[model samples]
Target chain A: MVDQPLAVAARSLFYRKKRHRDLRQRFIEVLLFLAALSSVLTTIAIMVLLVTESLPLFEKVSIIEFITGRDWAPLFDPPRYGILPLICGTFVTSMVALFVAIPMGTIAAMYLSEFAAPKLREVAKPVLEILAGIPTVVYGYFALLFVTPVLQMLYSPFGEKLSEWLPDIFPYELEGFNMLGPGIVMGIMITPTISSISEDAMRAVPVELREGSYATGATRFQTAWKVVFPAAISGIIASYILGISRAVGETMIVAVAAGLQPTLTLNPLRPAATITTYIVQVSLGDTPHGTIGYQTIFAAGLTLVLLTLFFNVIGYFLSRRFRETY
Target chain B: MQGSLAGVRGNIQRRQLWSAIFAIVGLLVLFIAIIVLLALILQLAIQGVPRLSWAFFTSFPSSKAEEAGILSALVGTALVMLVTAFTAIPIGIASGIYLEEYARKNWIAALIEINVTNLAGVPSIVYGLLAMGLFKSALQLGESVLTAGLTLALLILPVVIVTTREALRAIPSGLREAAYALGASKWQMVWDHILPYASGSILTGIIIGLSRAIGETAPLITIGALTFISFLPPSPFKSDFPFLSFDWVRSPFTVMPIQMFNWVSRPEPEFQLNAAAAGVILVALTLLMNGLAIYLRYRFRKGVKW
Candidate 1:
């Protein structure tokens, strides 16, 4: 009887330990699964709402008209559905931003990574990153107040000289608020993003490469450009593409500095509108939530989302393809 | 042969010159960033320093222009942030802890990791839409500060998880083994030995993530934060408190950005100046939070060892 009681107690203890272990494992698994699920729910719910609202706009306006129309007068009585002007404006502004950001940002990264002393790199890197941490609204104010005035001064004097060279084709009015001003400000805003990521890529290149180049009597500059820079080319390219995406997605600076005209002219000095700016415009209006006018905001959002998604996909694949092979 | 060697040296020198040019260009980029920061700070001080007074922080929004104050918005923002931090940090840190310490090498874990990486890149407006459906439609939380906080929490979960994993990874596995060897259980080893050592890293990451969450305007706007709340909620969870009631949940609440947007969009040039002043305050707050987080991170990295 004593042996039976002892055996029964042992069995109970064994079962309890097994159950506790199983419970702990299950608990952790459940928590992680919930975390992952939260992300999916977020992505799916956004798509659904955007689609539901945008469907009404599609019903009233043809998809072709939305894509190919030259004018955007959504606030006017006869609301036009042409999205081309906004799309062109977005692309031109973003391209200008890219042109300004890439060379400057790449050089900055190179200087910090290859040229600057350790103390300088440490000091400069964080200060540059602090630019990124500044709020977009502040940048918007800077663009509206400072950048516009500076550009206006350049255009006022230069515009007359250029017009004299070609009177027939160049009848220019240098607007203080135009794509040029916003593009310049956007370029500055995106510089930190490009420099930080590119610097990380450059720093990842092994010191052995630098040492080997130097053994052949290569200068510090020579080793950085021919050997180290080429090695990190893919990452550098990826950073620039990421910068392009950011420039395109940027909202506040463009909305504030760029003039609110949806004209489809190719000129950089003209006041232009972007998709994000259009979304802000409609959202701020008195349009009812369920109306077609309101739905256009979702359509604009969908376009922005799709464009960013495409760019991110390309960037993801390229970066993954080169994943720090060192 | 000596002439050819000289030619090769000339080629090398040209390359070096180009490299110097590139380096100068890089320095130019950093210079532009610095110049912009300086210009913004100077502009803000020149314009906003005179206008910033007790009345600006304490008064209520008014159509009469001069009577405007951000008191209610400030309180509302604080309440939303505290609630957001309270709800988000626990779950975010827990999920991070599980993935870093407990999850074994398996497909399930890999799937979770990939999902989280992608989630961090999704747009904030999308998160807003999601909050509208989940909390507003399904859970019936409505468009209150609680819903807004939860939405922002969800938006930043991936960031928190990623940072926490990095922090945990920084801790060597030897410490975990040492805890187990002392006859500590798995949970005890983690809670006692691992968490304390990594607390500084986790706190720094959390503060950084929280700062980002605080400045986010998209998700909050989507969750339907009222653009104007005249009174504070009587209780934290009550429909209304200090100035407004919970009934305002269904109404549009204005945040700093939304308010700034309102002011700037007007044709009145005075509003643009007001926008600049408001922007200075907002920038100051964000920078302070960010600076603190960065300092904490630097301290943690320098002083601590695995």
Candidate 2:
């Protein structure tokens, strides 16, 4: 009977300790759950902040005018609130960036994933990563000081000569703060992003597929371009979308190099204000709260968010689809 | 048969020539990217190296370009990073742990995953707007160090969480099974086994995230970081009782990039030199951090067998 009581007491003590551990486990789990939830909360917070702040501005100015109007002057008497010019600037620069990035990024990805020796790949990968790691602000500095001067020098004479032949298209010369310099620099900034992701997608293709192509007596380039590229098309497209989203959302490069004049021009040689540059210009000034000037940023922000969100969602889904396919 | 063989040989030769051309083109593109990086560093060094001096580190902004220093900006960046590191590290690690360990394959986990991926794609400037509305206006934090720190923390949270989860996932499953076999609870298994094994990689992720955060000028600019601040915030130390103080977090700040921006935008050529000098320091700091992270990752990868 004494042995039975001792056994029961020891068992009860063990159970109590286990119970305490269980309670602590639950508490810690809950804390972690809340931590994970915070990201969703941040998304919610951003949405709520943008919508609530933008509603007041929308009430004063119609959404159609904000999206479709060509003028963006909100500080002057009878201030206009058209955002089309900013959109045009964003589009032109991003298009220029894409023109440079796509070919360079794709070729680089092909070389890295298909042709480069393992030793060379190891060295090159980190160098590319370092390119991505360099600050956009430095790129901005390069765009304004170095790239612009070079472009102006190269284009000044060329534009002059070309205008003699085609006055309509080549009338304007490259300005000090034109879209081309920042656009080209932004292309350089975004190349690593596109190449790295596309390389990953290419690398994920089955090795047997490459071997099969080689067995057919195909050259490395032929196999890479015909087989691997097609196989990784979805992922490559995803990278392009992501790169486009990044270029659209890029701020400092345009703000520092591309002038803040909101001109609706397709000319890469002209200076214009992008949506991001406009936001930066306005934010740099002291526009009092609740005023149309201050709220304009929120309106601009909402547009930026929606535009990026559209691309990001597509890119995310396409990337996920690619992962599933392979 | 001889003619057909000749045609086949010619076709193969053409294919080989095209392949050779593409290989050279690809190599050229790769070199161009590398050359761009080298050129940036070279340009910054040539322009900024002459401006680096003992006086440059201790002085504040002045009307004369030669008289200005980065003391206030440096202090501001350090304090803001301090705040960002403390706030981001714990929360990011915890969230990563939760998603990797505890969460079931359900809607909540799916939602959080999607949110993180999308947030990573959101532009940095938008984060600044969020901070302006939520922190500066709604919470009345104004344009203070705390507000800037919090904004960056939110911005980098997704990076940290993604890296932590990746590190945790890389730990061999045998370790988890062994812990469970030892009658350890789930939390104990993670704490005792998974985390220690993944610490090196997690730390590397933290450094990289911080390095990116350090170079960020857009979000801070959007949050209304000052272009010129002649004085430093209150120090976080005191000689009296309770020697620690957080009064500095509420103080207005100007970071290195913002200072560089202010100088870069100036009309004078002298200010451009000052901006270039600041750029050198900023780039050096970011490169140092990223280099350290890369080295740590390489070392840990080589050291850990499993």
Candidate 3:
């Protein structure tokens, strides 16, 4: 009878331990839920704050004027909040980035998936990602010191040719800091992002498809172009859209390489200010908090956010519409 | 029949030739990408080697800004990074586990997954505002290291969560079933079996997250980390150390990016050179962390790939 009582006590203790563990798990679950929810909540709050603060900007500067007006004298006594100059600059750089990133990224992904041997694939993928690993600040330095100098050197020989050609072919002054420098650097920055994703997408295509084409004696190029790439098109486009989102959001490189003068010009060679560059400029210069100058940055930030968000939506849609393999 | 066979052979030759051309073009793209990276490395190494000094590593920021070294910035960066990792890793891993192994496939779980994806894509500067509003002003943490670290934690949380989930998913179902058949409890199986299998992957994810957090500049600037700080942080809890201690919530500290940015924007030649030096440091740290993550990922793939 004494032994039975001790056994019962031990059984009760075990049950209590289970209950305690269950409670602790529930607590952990709640905390995880809260942490995840906080991210969403934080995003919502930022949107609200941006909208509320940006309202004054819209009120002061009409949407059309903000979007289309060419002058960028926001710091003058009578501030000009014509945002088009910045928008144009941002677009020019982003478009140039796309031009450089897309063909190269897609081609590299195709090569890695369809052409490279297994060992080479393993080596090349990580080497390509080194571009992603390099900090944006370094890319900025490369653009300013190396790329700018190289461009200047290349142009120096063409100076007389350009001077001869200016009236007929060129209509603007040549500047050291221009879209060509930053666009090329930004392209390099975005290349790895596109390649990594596109490579994944290409790899997702069933080997059977490639085998089918090869069985028909289709050349590897024909098999890749007519069969594999088309099948991988959706993923490839999604990768390109992702690259665009990255290009739009890039800050440091553009701020450094693209001079922060919001000029209204279509010329890629002339100095211009991107939206990110503008934010960097306004934030760094002497601008008191709660002032219109500070508010301008928020407005500019809102534009950048909305533009990127729109691209993200497009990217998500493309991924859903085009996703072939799981 | 002989003539037809000859034609067929010619067609095969043409196809092989085209494949060769495509292969060459692909290799060319790879070459260009690699060359750009090599160029960046060489440029940084050549410019930054001379600036690498004991004084550069140990001295504080100077009033003659061009003369300033990066000691305090490095310390402040380390403190912020350590604190951010401490806060973010546990929560991120747990949530990842829950989503991967535990959570029911319900609407709520699906919503959580979507939210995390969108959060990953959200620009980082938004997180800075969140820190400014939630940690800095509302919670009264102020523009200090702690707040900045917390803010960065939030920014990197989605990345960590996604990566950790992928890692957990890679653990085979047989392991789970075997543990359960042996009468191991759910928590016991996860703690003992699943986590060990997933640890390499999880570590890789965390390191990648750390790299992203360290390079982040926008949120730190938004949350009020100073562009300059002369003194090193005393401790994690020192209020005077900005984000380090709870005691000095209002003090300012400069991070590597902001400091480099300040120098780069200056018109002085010396500052520009120093910016190059700082860029080298920042790039080195980022690349090292990323290399570790990539290596870990390769290990995971090699060990686990079917």
Candidate 4:
């Protein structure tokens, strides 16, 4: 009877411990689920805040006008709340930045993935990452000081006499602070992003494919250009979209280098404000929270958020479309 | 016919020569990237190093560029980073664990996975906008260090989560199976075996994310963190009876990047030099964080076989 009691006690203890562990596991699982859910919540919050704050602006101002009209002077006596100038600025600078980044980044990726020795690759990767790690503000400084000065030297002469040769096509003088300066610096800042991602995509191309090209009497250049390039095109396009998204959302470089003057212009060598820089410009001054000036920035923020999201979604789909190939 | 064969052989040799030439050209292209990086460093160093006096680190920002210092901004940055790390690390690692370990291949798990990846690429300024509306206006936190820190936490959370998932994914599934066979529960298996193994790289990810936060300016600006603060917030540690204080969290603050940005905008040459000096300090801080992360990752790679 005593032996029976002792055995029962030991059995009960085991059951209790098992129950405790199961309960603890459930508790931790809940905690982790909440943690993971927080990220989804963050995205929802962003969309919600942007929509709520910007709805007021769209309600007061015509959405079509906001999208298509010419000026961005929300604080003027008459208040022209047109965002076309900001859109033009965003597009002009991003296109220019992409122009510099795409070719340079792709070439660097080709060298890194196909040509460089392993030792060289190792040494070079951190250097490029360091380039990537540099604060955009530093690039902004570089844009204003070094790049603007150099551009002044090279373009100053042409800028002065350009009207004589290409009337209505060129500015008579390019300001020290202009779209080209920030656009070029932004390109350099994003180069590492493009190169690293492209290198990954190119590296994923199978060794058999490269070897097969060589077996067919293809030169190294021929194999890289004809075979590998086509195979990696999807990945390349995805990275390009991501790069363009970066250029679009970049704030510091453009805000610091390009003068925060919201003007509608096609010229790259002119001071213009992008959507991101406009937000910074307003925040720099003391616009009361409830005022039209303050709310206009939210409208701008919504535009920027939507624009970048569109690019992000596109890049995501492009990468997914080609993933099965790998 | 022999002469034709000789011609074909000579063509092969010439093709090989040109292939070698193409490779050399590729190297030359890479050199251009290097030149860009070097030029940035050379310019910053030339402008900044000359202005790195003791006063630059000690004094508060002044109207006169000659007397301006980054002391208050540096303190604000450190304070913000501490709060950011405290909030981001736990949530990120927990989510990483959940996604990689606990969750089944169901829709919810996939949703969080996609959400994290998307959030990582969502521009940092968007995070700021969200923080502005939600934290500053709705919750009424205003432009305090607390709000900035929390905003930064959200900004870097995706980075932390993605990197943490990567680190945990590297741990062999065999380890999980081994723990399960030992009668360990799923959470127990994760806490005991997986976490300890992946901690090094998890730490590396956190450090890297924090480094990015330190250099970020756009979001903080949107939240209305001041560009000029002459005095430091009350110390995080109290000099009086209650030893540790969070009064600093609610205080007005400016960070190094904002201070640097403000000075860089001034028309004076002196302000440009001050901005460069501040830039050097900010870069040094980021590089230190990154170097630590790199070192930790190296150690982790060396220590782990799989």
Q: Score candidate 4 by DockQ.
A: 0.71
The C-alpha stretches of model 1 lying farther than 4 A from their native spots are A1-11, A74-78, A158-170, A286-289, A320-324, B1-22, B103-108, B129-142, B182-186, B221-228, B237-252
Ranking by lDDT: 2, 4, 3, 1
Over 4 Å off, model 3: A1-17, A62-65, A158-161, A164-166, A286-289, B1-12, B63-66, B236-250, B303-306
**Docking category for candidate 4?**
medium
Residue pairs in collision within model 4 = none
Ranking by TM-score: 2, 4, 3, 1
lDDT at residue B147 of model 1 (Cα atoms): 83
- Model 2 agreement with the true structure over B1-306: per-residue lDDT tens digits: 347988899989999999999999988998999998998898899999899999999999999999999999999999999999999999999999999999999999999998998899899999998999989999999999999999999999999999999999999999999999999999999999999999999999999999999989898988899978999899899999899998999999999989988898888999999989999999899889988998899899999997
- DockQ values for all predictions? 0.47, 0.83, 0.51, 0.71
Which parts of model 4 are misplaced by more than 4 Å? A156-171, A320-326, B1-18, B239-242
- What is the lDDT of every predicted structure here? 0.75, 0.91, 0.80, 0.87
Q: Comparing candidate 3 with candidate 4, which one achieves the higher TM-score? A: 4
Model 3, range B238-296, lDDT digits (tens) per residue? 44536554443344677888887777777877777777788889988998998998988
Q: Name the docking class for model 1.
A: acceptable
Q: Indicate the residue-level lDDT of A138 in model 3.
A: 72
Candidate 2 chain B lDDT trough over 10 residues, lowest sum? B1-10
Q: Tell me the spans in candidate 2 whose CA falls farther than 4 Å from its real position.
A: A157-169, A316-326, B1-3
Assess the local accuracy of residue B156 in candidate 4 as a C-alpha lDDT between 0 and 100: 91
Error of 2 at A313 (Å): 3.4
Per-structure clash totals for the candidates: 27, 0, 10, 0
Better of 1 and 2 by DockQ: 2
**Model 4: per-residue lDDT, tens digit, A1-326?**
76998899999999999999889888989999999999999989998888888888888898999998898899888889889999899999999899888988888888888888899998777777778788889889999999988887776475554545566776467788899988988988888889888898889999889999999989887788777877887788778988998999999999999999999998888899999999998888775567786688889988988898888878778877866374
